[model samples]
Target: MQQISINTPALLFPAITLLMLAYTNRFLALATLIRNLHTKYKQGQEDRNLLRQQIKNLRRRLLLIKQMQASGITSFFCCVLCMLFFYIGYEGWAYGIFGLSLGFLLLSLVLSLNEIYISTKALEIELKDME
Candidate 1:
Protein backbone atom coordinates (compact mmCIF):
# COMPACT_ATOMS: atom_id res chain seq x y z
CA MET A 1 0.00 0.00 0.00
CA GLN A 2 1.17 3.49 -0.81
CA GLN A 3 2.02 5.64 2.19
CA ILE A 4 -0.70 8.25 2.65
CA SER A 5 -0.13 11.75 3.94
CA ILE A 6 -2.08 12.91 6.98
CA ASN A 7 -3.73 15.49 4.74
CA THR A 8 -5.61 12.74 2.91
CA PRO A 9 -8.05 12.03 5.73
CA ALA A 10 -8.13 15.68 6.72
CA LEU A 11 -9.84 16.38 3.40
CA LEU A 12 -13.05 14.79 4.71
CA PHE A 13 -13.47 17.28 7.56
CA PRO A 14 -15.40 19.86 5.56
CA ALA A 15 -17.56 17.31 3.81
CA ILE A 16 -18.50 15.65 7.09
CA THR A 17 -19.21 19.01 8.68
CA LEU A 18 -21.59 19.97 5.88
CA LEU A 19 -23.34 16.61 6.07
CA MET A 20 -23.88 16.96 9.81
CA LEU A 21 -25.26 20.44 9.31
CA ALA A 22 -27.78 19.16 6.79
CA TYR A 23 -28.82 16.35 9.09
CA THR A 24 -29.34 18.78 11.94
CA ASN A 25 -31.48 20.98 9.75
CA ARG A 26 -33.63 18.03 8.80
CA PHE A 27 -34.03 17.12 12.47
CA LEU A 28 -35.03 20.64 13.44
CA ALA A 29 -37.59 20.85 10.67
CA LEU A 30 -39.08 17.52 11.74
CA ALA A 31 -39.30 18.71 15.33
CA THR A 32 -41.22 21.80 14.27
CA LEU A 33 -43.62 19.72 12.21
CA ILE A 34 -44.25 17.37 15.12
CA ARG A 35 -44.95 20.28 17.45
CA ASN A 36 -47.43 21.79 15.03
CA LEU A 37 -49.11 18.43 14.56
CA HIS A 38 -49.42 18.02 18.31
CA THR A 39 -51.10 21.43 18.60
CA LYS A 40 -53.51 20.59 15.79
CA TYR A 41 -54.34 17.27 17.33
CA LYS A 42 -55.03 18.90 20.66
CA GLN A 43 -57.31 21.44 19.00
CA GLY A 44 -59.28 18.61 17.36
CA GLN A 45 -58.87 19.99 13.84
CA GLU A 46 -57.46 17.06 11.92
CA ASP A 47 -58.87 13.59 11.43
CA ARG A 48 -57.61 11.07 13.96
CA ASN A 49 -56.50 8.44 11.43
CA LEU A 50 -54.68 10.98 9.29
CA LEU A 51 -52.90 12.40 12.33
CA ARG A 52 -51.95 8.91 13.44
CA GLN A 53 -50.49 8.07 10.03
CA GLN A 54 -48.48 11.27 9.92
CA ILE A 55 -47.13 10.57 13.35
CA LYS A 56 -46.07 7.08 12.31
CA ASN A 57 -44.26 8.48 9.27
CA LEU A 58 -42.57 11.08 11.42
CA ARG A 59 -41.45 8.41 13.85
CA ARG A 60 -39.77 6.43 11.09
CA ARG A 61 -38.11 9.53 9.70
CA LEU A 62 -36.85 10.55 13.13
CA LEU A 63 -35.26 7.15 13.61
CA LEU A 64 -33.57 7.38 10.22
CA ILE A 65 -32.19 10.83 11.00
CA LYS A 66 -30.81 9.59 14.30
CA GLN A 67 -29.07 6.71 12.55
CA MET A 68 -27.72 9.07 9.92
CA GLN A 69 -26.28 11.39 12.52
CA ALA A 70 -24.67 8.52 14.38
CA SER A 71 -23.06 7.17 11.23
CA GLY A 72 -21.83 10.61 10.17
CA ILE A 73 -20.30 11.21 13.60
CA THR A 74 -18.60 7.80 13.51
CA SER A 75 -17.20 8.63 10.07
CA PHE A 76 -15.89 11.97 11.24
CA PHE A 77 -14.19 10.37 14.25
CA CYS A 78 -12.66 7.65 12.08
CA CYS A 79 -11.29 10.26 9.72
CA VAL A 80 -9.58 12.06 12.58
CA LEU A 81 -8.21 8.76 13.85
CA CYS A 82 -6.97 7.93 10.38
CA MET A 83 -5.03 11.14 10.27
CA LEU A 84 -3.61 10.48 13.72
CA PHE A 85 -2.46 6.99 12.75
CA PHE A 86 -0.80 8.31 9.62
CA TYR A 87 1.03 10.99 11.56
CA ILE A 88 2.37 8.30 13.90
CA GLY A 89 3.77 6.26 10.99
CA TYR A 90 1.13 3.52 10.93
CA GLU A 91 0.36 3.49 7.22
CA GLY A 92 -1.61 0.25 7.22
CA TRP A 93 -3.76 1.25 10.18
CA ALA A 94 -4.41 4.61 8.62
CA TYR A 95 -5.55 2.95 5.44
CA GLY A 96 -7.91 0.65 7.33
CA ILE A 97 -9.37 3.49 9.34
CA PHE A 98 -9.83 5.59 6.25
CA GLY A 99 -11.72 2.70 4.68
CA LEU A 100 -13.98 2.49 7.70
CA SER A 101 -14.60 6.24 7.51
CA LEU A 102 -15.69 5.96 3.89
CA GLY A 103 -17.99 3.08 4.74
CA PHE A 104 -19.65 5.01 7.53
CA LEU A 105 -20.07 8.07 5.34
CA LEU A 106 -21.77 5.88 2.74
CA LEU A 107 -24.09 4.48 5.37
CA SER A 108 -24.97 7.98 6.54
CA LEU A 109 -25.81 9.06 3.01
CA VAL A 110 -28.00 6.00 2.43
CA LEU A 111 -29.90 6.70 5.62
CA SER A 112 -30.33 10.32 4.64
CA LEU A 113 -31.79 9.32 1.29
CA ASN A 114 -34.21 6.96 2.95
CA GLU A 115 -35.29 9.69 5.33
CA ILE A 116 -35.90 12.04 2.43
CA TYR A 117 -38.11 9.46 0.80
CA ILE A 118 -40.16 9.04 3.95
CA SER A 119 -40.46 12.81 4.31
CA THR A 120 -41.88 13.02 0.79
CA LYS A 121 -44.41 10.37 1.69
CA ALA A 122 -45.61 12.56 4.53
CA LEU A 123 -46.06 15.43 2.11
CA GLU A 124 -48.03 13.16 -0.16
CA ILE A 125 -50.32 12.33 2.71
CA GLU A 126 -51.00 16.00 3.24
CA LEU A 127 -51.64 16.52 -0.47
CA LYS A 128 -54.13 13.72 -0.54
CA ASP A 129 -56.18 15.55 2.06
CA MET A 130 -56.17 18.66 -0.10
CA GLU A 131 -57.49 16.76 -3.10
Candidate 2:
Protein backbone atom coordinates (compact mmCIF):
# COMPACT_ATOMS: atom_id res chain seq x y z
CA MET A 1 0.00 0.00 0.00
CA GLN A 2 1.21 3.47 -0.86
CA GLN A 3 1.96 5.73 2.09
CA ILE A 4 -0.82 8.33 2.43
CA SER A 5 -0.12 11.94 3.20
CA ILE A 6 -2.05 13.70 5.96
CA ASN A 7 -3.51 15.91 3.26
CA THR A 8 -5.33 12.95 1.68
CA PRO A 9 -7.92 12.58 4.42
CA ALA A 10 -7.99 16.33 4.95
CA LEU A 11 -9.50 16.68 1.48
CA LEU A 12 -12.81 15.25 2.71
CA PHE A 13 -13.35 17.99 5.29
CA PRO A 14 -14.99 20.46 2.93
CA ALA A 15 -17.08 17.82 1.20
CA ILE A 16 -18.39 16.48 4.47
CA THR A 17 -19.11 19.98 5.73
CA LEU A 18 -21.16 20.76 2.65
CA LEU A 19 -23.09 17.49 2.90
CA MET A 20 -23.98 18.16 6.53
CA LEU A 21 -25.11 21.64 5.64
CA ALA A 22 -27.45 20.23 2.99
CA TYR A 23 -28.83 17.66 5.41
CA THR A 24 -29.50 20.37 7.97
CA ASN A 25 -31.32 22.43 5.38
CA ARG A 26 -33.51 19.48 4.51
CA PHE A 27 -34.26 18.92 8.19
CA LEU A 28 -35.23 22.56 8.67
CA ALA A 29 -37.56 22.49 5.69
CA LEU A 30 -39.24 19.37 6.98
CA ALA A 31 -39.67 20.98 10.39
CA THR A 32 -41.30 23.99 8.84
CA LEU A 33 -43.66 21.80 6.83
CA ILE A 34 -44.64 19.84 9.91
CA ARG A 35 -45.38 23.02 11.80
CA ASN A 36 -47.51 24.33 8.98
CA LEU A 37 -49.38 21.04 8.81
CA HIS A 38 -49.97 21.15 12.53
CA THR A 39 -51.49 24.57 12.24
CA LYS A 40 -53.74 23.46 9.42
CA TYR A 41 -54.89 20.48 11.39
CA LYS A 42 -55.66 22.64 14.39
CA GLN A 43 -57.72 24.93 12.19
CA GLY A 44 -59.59 21.98 10.61
CA GLN A 45 -58.25 22.86 7.18
CA GLU A 46 -56.41 19.60 6.54
CA ASP A 47 -57.87 16.16 5.99
CA ARG A 48 -57.06 13.79 8.82
CA ASN A 49 -55.85 10.84 6.75
CA LEU A 50 -53.68 12.94 4.46
CA LEU A 51 -52.19 14.71 7.41
CA ARG A 52 -51.49 11.40 9.10
CA GLN A 53 -49.76 10.06 6.02
CA GLN A 54 -47.73 13.19 5.63
CA ILE A 55 -46.67 12.99 9.24
CA LYS A 56 -45.63 9.39 8.77
CA ASN A 57 -43.56 10.28 5.73
CA LEU A 58 -41.96 13.17 7.54
CA ARG A 59 -41.12 10.96 10.50
CA ARG A 60 -39.36 8.46 8.27
CA ARG A 61 -37.50 11.23 6.50
CA LEU A 62 -36.40 12.70 9.80
CA LEU A 63 -35.07 9.32 10.90
CA LEU A 64 -33.14 8.97 7.67
CA ILE A 65 -31.65 12.41 8.10
CA LYS A 66 -30.57 11.53 11.61
CA GLN A 67 -28.88 8.36 10.39
CA MET A 68 -27.22 10.24 7.56
CA GLN A 69 -25.85 12.86 9.93
CA ALA A 70 -24.59 10.20 12.31
CA SER A 71 -22.79 8.39 9.54
CA GLY A 72 -21.31 11.61 8.22
CA ILE A 73 -20.04 12.50 11.67
CA THR A 74 -18.55 9.05 12.08
CA SER A 75 -16.84 9.40 8.71
CA PHE A 76 -15.40 12.74 9.66
CA PHE A 77 -14.19 11.40 13.00
CA CYS A 78 -12.54 8.42 11.33
CA CYS A 79 -10.85 10.70 8.81
CA VAL A 80 -9.34 12.77 11.62
CA LEU A 81 -8.22 9.63 13.37
CA CYS A 82 -6.63 8.43 10.14
CA MET A 83 -4.65 11.62 9.94
CA LEU A 84 -3.57 11.26 13.53
CA PHE A 85 -2.47 7.68 12.99
CA PHE A 86 -0.52 8.63 9.88
CA TYR A 87 1.25 11.45 11.70
CA ILE A 88 2.27 8.98 14.44
CA GLY A 89 3.70 6.54 11.86
CA TYR A 90 0.97 3.89 12.27
CA GLU A 91 0.60 3.26 8.56
CA GLY A 92 -1.51 0.10 8.90
CA TRP A 93 -3.97 1.66 11.32
CA ALA A 94 -4.15 4.80 9.21
CA TYR A 95 -5.02 2.78 6.14
CA GLY A 96 -7.74 0.88 7.95
CA ILE A 97 -9.22 4.01 9.43
CA PHE A 98 -9.16 5.72 6.05
CA GLY A 99 -11.06 2.79 4.53
CA LEU A 100 -13.65 2.94 7.29
CA SER A 101 -14.01 6.67 6.72
CA LEU A 102 -14.74 6.13 3.06
CA GLY A 103 -17.26 3.40 3.83
CA PHE A 104 -19.12 5.58 6.30
CA LEU A 105 -19.17 8.47 3.87
CA LEU A 106 -20.68 6.21 1.24
CA LEU A 107 -23.35 5.11 3.67
CA SER A 108 -24.18 8.70 4.50
CA LEU A 109 -24.55 9.58 0.84
CA VAL A 110 -26.80 6.59 0.17
CA LEU A 111 -29.07 7.55 3.03
CA SER A 112 -29.19 11.11 1.80
CA LEU A 113 -30.24 9.95 -1.65
CA ASN A 114 -32.98 7.78 -0.22
CA GLU A 115 -34.26 10.68 1.87
CA ILE A 116 -34.36 12.85 -1.22
CA TYR A 117 -36.46 10.25 -2.99
CA ILE A 118 -38.90 10.11 -0.10
CA SER A 119 -39.07 13.89 -0.01
CA THR A 120 -39.97 13.97 -3.69
CA LYS A 121 -42.72 11.47 -3.09
CA ALA A 122 -44.14 13.70 -0.39
CA LEU A 123 -44.18 16.57 -2.84
CA GLU A 124 -45.93 14.39 -5.34
CA ILE A 125 -48.64 13.63 -2.82
CA GLU A 126 -49.16 17.33 -2.29
CA LEU A 127 -49.26 18.01 -6.00
CA LYS A 128 -51.83 15.30 -6.50
CA ASP A 129 -54.08 17.01 -4.01
CA MET A 130 -53.89 20.15 -6.08
CA GLU A 131 -55.07 18.34 -9.20
Assess each prediction's global lDDT (C-alpha) against the native: 0.95, 0.93
Model 2 misplaced regions, further than 4 Å: none
Looking at candidate 2, the ten consecutive residues that score lowest on lDDT are 47-56
What is residue 5's positional error in candidate 1, in angstroms? Answer: 1.6
Clashing residue pairs in candidate 2 (N, C-alpha, C atoms within 3 angstroms): none
lDDT of 1 by residue, 58-120 (tens): 999999999999999999999999998988889888999999999999999999999999999
Q: Give the winner by lDDT.
A: 1
Question: Which pairs of residues have clashing backbones in candidate 1?
Answer: none
lDDT, candidate 2, 25-93, per-residue tens: 988998999899989988999978788789989999999999999999999999999999999999899
TM-scores for all predictions: 0.97, 0.96
Candidate 2 lDDT score at position 14: 99
